[model samples]
Target: MRKIPVKYGIEILVICLTPFLFMISESISNGKVTGILFSFGYLILVGFVIFGIRYWIENEELVIQNLLFWKTRIRISEVSKIEKTWNALSSPAPSITGRVEIYYNKKSIVISPKNFEEFKNELLRINPNIIIKE
Candidate 1:
């Protein structure tokens, strides 16, 4: 199974921290306590974002293993269909990020892979029975 690259996380960190850095710098110039607080809060938020992304990337697999939660394994044969879905209102909206929906036994699970096309192709190779819908 493929995993997200470290650069992806770094890129995300840079993107997110840019505004925070700007705010912190401006606050320093103005000498306001609010700016310092905001900077601290943003730092914590960025750390959490980094950790969450890393965890999701590392743990993303067809067969998920969890100590607290039950292990779930999706067999290739059980997959009936694969599709890419998008919606406007969803938090972490599909417009900004792409998602893969895997249909099996009348249920579906969605995962966001770094390389969506390659992920779909691998899944198709594993299960030729899987229908790829536009």
Candidate 2:
């Protein structure tokens, strides 16, 4: 099984900083103890969610492990197209950069694996007929 790392760049930075910002704002308005607890809880939740998101290829399928519970599997034979995209629109992609859009089942999902080329090539290997749009 090949594990593909997610490219969490500036987007992750923003996400990591948001709770702290909120914590500071809350502390100024409310109280220190409450703000810290809330911020810690938020941080733990975000960390757990991010830690859970993973992508891998196994048994001729692309597996998307999400939020520690949700798993989205796409069969290799069903893949119709693969394309590189810079779209920041929210999707399965964890990052705002180096994303790939996979088309299948009359639908598509975006993902940002660290090795974008390798990920695309692996998918192409699985489905040689898949059209790759630059």
Candidate 3:
């Protein structure tokens, strides 16, 4: 099992909430009902950040847990291919770091591991049939 690095969680939270902070500050300057709404929004944003951080810290098996919705894991023999590709729109924005693709049969999953090269090599060691692409 592998855990997401704490720095990645903090970076993501900061990037997402920085714009809202600016908006909230502007609303306060305007001195209107908008300020109250912005304040509430800020609280909600903070809540999300907290949840994300907790999730990152609690989760293990980086790819398996992070891409569970996609059912990434299967018996090693079932894997047909593994390749790496980049797409700003479909992939996670701002590219958290150490991103890779895990392919099994007809399905594919995206995950960001803490030590990408080591993770890939480990996977290959586990299942030599699995392919790795640059």
Off by over 4 Å in 1: 4-26, 54-77, 88-97, 105-109
The per-prediction tally of clashing pairs is 0, 0, 1
List CA RMSD, all candidates: 5.7, 1.9, 5.2
lDDT for predicted candidate 1 compared with the true structure: 0.59
The CA lDDT at 120 in model 2 is: 79
Candidate 2 local lDDT, 4-74, one digit each (tens): 88877776768777867878688867768877777778878877776677999999999998778888899
Candidate 3 residue-wise lDDT, 1-134, digit = tens: 43444224456567667777777777778876777697777878565434433112212222343222432235545555666555333333224554566677677655555556766665666677777787
Q: Could you say which candidate leads in lDDT?
A: 2
12-79 per-residue lDDT for model 1 (tens digits): 45777898899899999999999989998998876654444321222224653322344456776788
Better of 2 and 3 by lDDT: 2
The Cα local distance difference test for each model comes to 0.59, 0.83, 0.53
TM-score of each: 0.51, 0.88, 0.58
Whole-model lDDT, candidate 2? 0.83
Ranking by lDDT: 2, 1, 3
Candidate 3 wrong stretches, greater than 4 Å: 2-15, 32-63, 66-77, 90-97
